[model samples]
Target chain A: MSEIPSKWKCAVIQLHSKPMQLEDNFNRAQGFIRKAAEAGARLAVLPEYSLTSWVPDDPGFADAHVDREYLSKFCELAKECNINIVPGTFVERHVDDGKDMLYNVAHFISNEGKILGSYTKKNLWHTERAHLEAAGNNPHTVMDTPLGKVGLLICWDLAFPEAFRALIIQGAKIIIIPSFWNLLDLTEPAFQRNPRSEAIYLESIVISRAFENVSCIAFANVGGQKESGFAGLSQIAMPLMGDIARAEGAHEQMVIGEVDMEVLQDAEESYKVREDISRPDFHYPVYAKN
Target chain B: MSEIPSKWKCAVIQLHSKPMQLEDNFNRAQGFIRKAAEAGARLAVLPEYSLTSWVPDDPGFADAHVDREYLSKFCELAKECNINIVPGTFVERHVDDGKDMLYNVAHFISNEGKILGSYTKKNLWHTERAHLEAAGNNPHTVMDTPLGKVGLLICWDLAFPEAFRALIIQGAKIIIIPSFWNLLDLTEPAFQRNPRSEAIYLESIVISRAFENVSCIAFANVGGQKESGFAGLSQIAMPLMGDIARAEGAHEQMVIGEVDMEVLQDAEESYKVREDISRPDFHYPVYAKN
Candidate 1:
């Protein structure tokens, strides 16, 4: 095994984004990014819908609300800090013909103020289905970056293994998920919701996702009491080391995670998850066509 | 909300097979199955290679050792107990065009002394590749039983999500895994290993696999000190209940798990994991063939 020089540190920013306030959101994001840079983080990540309070229903919201400013600001911040950044998600409006359609798109920006790629969350929840359109084509993307092959996903994508496998097939070593995963409790008091078990559910998936893929995962989520209140167990999990760093529940915090190639290599060698996958065609039904 | 009559209880038999002593192994299995029946289990499952101390490097092992008696005995046991039994795996020698090849096949026996179906494991680990063969044609099978749509897989198949997804697509409400998941370690005595941490890794996958697929999982494994000391964390995790019961590490024990339709329904209704999988086409690459 060759000895590497320095470990790549990643930062997950858990923010309490103000409702409908773009200026304050970016300001908060900027402060966190600067702190992450000072702490020697080469890559900083934010949560899904970090700009505003979790998007509630408003038909004309996408057409009137979203702007190009968020992208420019994120690019500028990435360049200023000399670090790659995933600045959460924006409600993007697209014209398919004469109609305005909305999508939840996450932008990946490099340290050189260049847009690497963007991916829309394919699996939309019950609430999101009312307004946002799921991606018309493939939603998974693995962009080659200086730090690693960064795969972008958002929120509910964690529930789907196919998303991760798609990226892995395309050579993703690091998977980044920007999530606004709220504790989905029933609105009425009489509904009988189990309040305490949400973290167990979310955290279990996070740790297993990293373990099964044999890749580094950056799961960033929003903080504070919103919706049913976000379960802010924002974490960065390596292949072998379960959780490098994790945020407290519902607390706005910035935690650093070290992604070392050696640990990843060791885990892969020990488990042989990738190497053991000899017949991907048999497991994956898609390959039957050829 | 349907008021179901009685919960279907399933039992996972964690065993320690005596090396090469086939009679002693069956006697052990018979005792566990009896105990499971006494404990009110409708479906009883055993660990992979539970009939022998896991197949070692003996080229003539399958041809010389394996016989029809094991199958007849298991079928008789299932009939005697009147309980569905997945009697782990057996090394069966198959001759195609007069050539002898070996396969580790999991046999599904009905409660009426009839062989329901048999499935060979698809994903073979590094160690098994030396002696065994990877499945060639349609390795995935979901057998319909009175208890549930039972999906069969063994050991290392847990590492692959496609196996689970393939079964889920076939309407499997309960997935049964007969595993001989030997504790993966550093292989050298010089490399320090933490025994306690293995359960956490195994249990996490069990819980997440159940949650993601919205299906109940019956994970059975061998119990004893052998290859890297089998991590006997055999568990039954419901979609909502997580792990209803799990074996203590490396302990020879039998545990009961309730596979209630109401619990499964409630979990699906609340989380909507099955319903919310809208973009299966995009997420699953195989759907692109159409």
Candidate 2:
């Protein structure tokens, strides 16, 4: 096995995303990239649909999005910052079968200004199912990089452990989540009264997922206003230790932390936790036809 | 489908056990059952290995452990209290292939003094793997009860979402967990610095698991003292409201709450969440040969 990196600095770019606004989002992303570069980070992540926000209102809007200029700009940002970058997610417009199709694609940008590989979100949220195309037949993968094997997931995909475990089995040392987790005032009376509860739920899940998998999870979430609320508690959590850096509320901020694998010796060897699930007794419904 | 119950009250019996003292354990369990029955709880849950403390110090002890009298007292407690009971877990002593084997079993007792069904734990925690036998070939089943389709899960099984999701797919209305989550000062510097972090991680995961599945979860955990600490925090969590009733810290206490189907209308109809995982873009290592 390759020597686990002793020190790996990462940054999360949390933004106050304006829905359907391209220039505003791009400029804001550029600022975060610049800040991350200044902080000497080796890897950086942005929130889901960082350049366009979430749940597109217009169908035709994705047709012309993320063209040559947009794609090159991200590649250039990675090159300029000299950091491996995950530019949240972009609505990739392309031709599938005989018709037009758009998928939410999370791309891994190499430090040398090249697109390494990408993962199309398989699990689409209820709101996105009607608005976006799902990667129904796609295979899961881990993006190989100098820092480590990085697993990528979009917003709603966080709800499924199957996706995360797949990446871990394929040797994912770090998992990156780009979430537009804006938990608004729901019609449910209880949720309405306790608006911040959703954020708390999310923050808790992030820590548990990281500890269970024995990998570093970098979560980047968007910041939203009061009416269209966002429970923006983005964090970087490591195995067993929980969150080292956490952003609070719907305020635009940047969270930075070092994800060091050298520190996980006690967890990996003592428990053999990853091996705990190796037995054949468990079941997964994804493969179940019924 | 059977009509979802309008309101169902449940109880979680937390204990600070004296290992191997079956009388002390049973007497304590009886006291809690009596209290829950008085509080109008139709269903009561006890912690894992409630009949005896975990990892039998001596092998011969199992032969004399769960006698007919001990078993009947639990059943009689359920019958007397007039409440359905999940007696946490009993270390069932049985002979297989002319050799003695011990298995941890979670039993469901009917209010009418009948054995409704039982679930043997498939996933054994690392501490117990060397000391106890695993349920490799056992078929998973949700206990059919008057309250709801109660799916049973033990501690350490909580880390594996695959097992949890399987229960949800089988139409589990309320998932019951019996955990003995004891926190200790870790050798790892980070986890050692903050001992209560594991409990925090667990609390977060419980809330998310319930909300995501749209199932009510009744968690029962044991209490612990200074050196060998237990992060009790046993809770009754619902779809969107998070924890309605939670036991704070590692204190022996009974938490009671009504699992109401009326309040879940907003969560169930608006999002066909279980259907969100319908597509086949997933992976599971349990099926992996290697």
Candidate 3:
């Protein structure tokens, strides 16, 4: 047995996924995987709704919008790259909706290209609730990888701490979020069609979750703009008691980094704030409605 | 009356005050006021504890440490510049250690250099419970100003929506807050601290107070450090359907802005969100305690 443990390297790609362009989006995904593997990344994550746009009504496009063939090709790419991949959010025809309506899904594939598992976003965004069906799953689960155990939570799922906590309880060392965050929604509201002041709200949740969990968080997002207008900002953050890294804003290209399991290991020792500070057992009655 | 009524420009100076060095702190504040007056600001505010640090048991410190001679100097300055000044905080000397050990106070002085009224911080921070004593007072009472009816709250007081609502109920068109926020302490270890991963708990209170009340908010904060490393970030945020302007990072300077009473003359008519969405009576309970 080795005295020193090995470190795990993960890559995050922030891209502007062209809406409804399944072929182009798949190709982009394949390219990022190849580059990450070539650069020695053991795993890589993509943004939520990367298979298509978070744009309204695109999931219900023509009959040829999303299919198994598209996913099969992507799976082949993951196998060829020999690295774990989180192909962010995509639309899958729901059984209850008679395949007429779809559910927002996250696909996790192993380096050997075997389907690990999938998670559907539990708390659908107000905009999403307008079109998508809320999934019945718990939305928190950990996958056993060669480097470490990882958890998966989609875009809007960041707002719910309980979901991420559930995954951590299942022994997740790092949390991966695939997001298609539209920038026009927050910063450039004056010029966008639909302006949103929810950036503070979303950013608060992301930051608080990292601090509360004492784990590294990597979020890959769709950035840049479309011919139709709308953009995104991707970020990676760590609320560390010992080692914290937070980087936000537009990163429309491939970005790579290591999850640094050592950070999590050291966090176990340095979390002074978490030691008997928040009395959740007592605050439960108070915070339940909030 | 002229076609264009006389305008009132306000400046909220967010200062980072130290636990010691009273002379230097006052001089730095004077510098900001001079600059604001030169830029045509008629009214300005300072943050809570701008006179002294929030910690207890520092040498030569008392709960009520309001020095009358120094206040006279401020009155002289306001009179010289023909400006209105809000005294952020002071150590008001008191008779009862239990009743008024320390006061989180705000002094609204008119342009004519007359003391209007003072609003002590009603909602004390967690640390305040141990370091200082809370003062009992009317939650909200509007002050008649030459410009309009103005309302006030100290740092922790802003967290209570009812305080702002009480001000609005009395027909306050403008709200001012003098804050002394220590960003470093806001980390998890401090119960008074919000998670620093993002700026939610702090930013949300300021943003919500402005949006819900339909009144302009001018927030001044104490900045810089003295003996310790406490810091501050302050700004003057306008009342819009969403956030108007925000200042991030350590702000030891003055933030000035103008708000046209006409903008809120028919606020319910202009902002469709406030007109259609807001229900003050149905406000969900905020600020729950364990």
Query: What fraction of the correct interface contacts does each predicted structure contain?
Result: 0.26, 0.35, 0.02
lDDT of each residue in A1-290, candidate 1, tens digit only? 12322478999999877777778888989999999999888889999888866646544346434567778988998898888899988888888769878888888898887989899888776678887888846546688777767788898888888778777766678899898877654232212334534566677788888888878889998887644556899999865567778997687889898777566666676677765443455445422122
The TM-score of predicted model 2 comes to: 0.92
What is residue B82's positional error in candidate 2, in angstroms?
1.1
- Residue-wise lDDT of candidate 2 within A1-290, one digit each (tens)? 24536687889988877777778888888888888889888888889888777646665457536464676888998898888888888888778888888888888888888988888988777677786788865767887787778888887777667777777767777889998886763455646545665665686678777877777889998877747777888899876667878886678888899776765555665445555544353344233221
Which stretches of model 2 miss by more than 4 angstroms?
A1-4, A64-66, A185-194, A278-290, B1-4, B185-194, B263-265, B277-290
Q: Score the docking of each candidate (DockQ).
A: 0.34, 0.41, 0.09
Which model, 1 or 2, shows the larger lDDT? 1
Question: B151-259, model 1: which lDDT tens digit per residue?
Answer: 8888878877778877777777788889887665433321232343345568688888988888889999888864556788899987656788888768778888776
| lDDT values, one for every candidate | 0.76, 0.74, 0.61
Compare candidates 2 and 3 on TM-score and give the better one: 2
By TM-score rank, best first, the candidates go 2, 1, 3
TM-score of each candidate structure, all chains considered together: 0.90, 0.92, 0.62
Worst 10 residues of 3 chain A by lDDT: A281-290
Clashing pairs in 1: A286-B286
- Model 2, B1-290: lDDT tens digits are 24446887889878776677778888888888898899899888889877666646766456545565776777887888788888888777778899778877777887766778877777777677776787765656676787768788887777767666777667777888888777763455655645766676677778777777777888888766646777888888876678888887676778898877654555655445655443253333222121
Q: What DockQ does model 1 achieve? A: 0.34
In angstroms, what RMSD does candidate 3 have relative to the true structure?
7.9
- When just chain B is superposed on the true chain B, each candidate scores a TM-score of 0.89, 0.88, 0.82
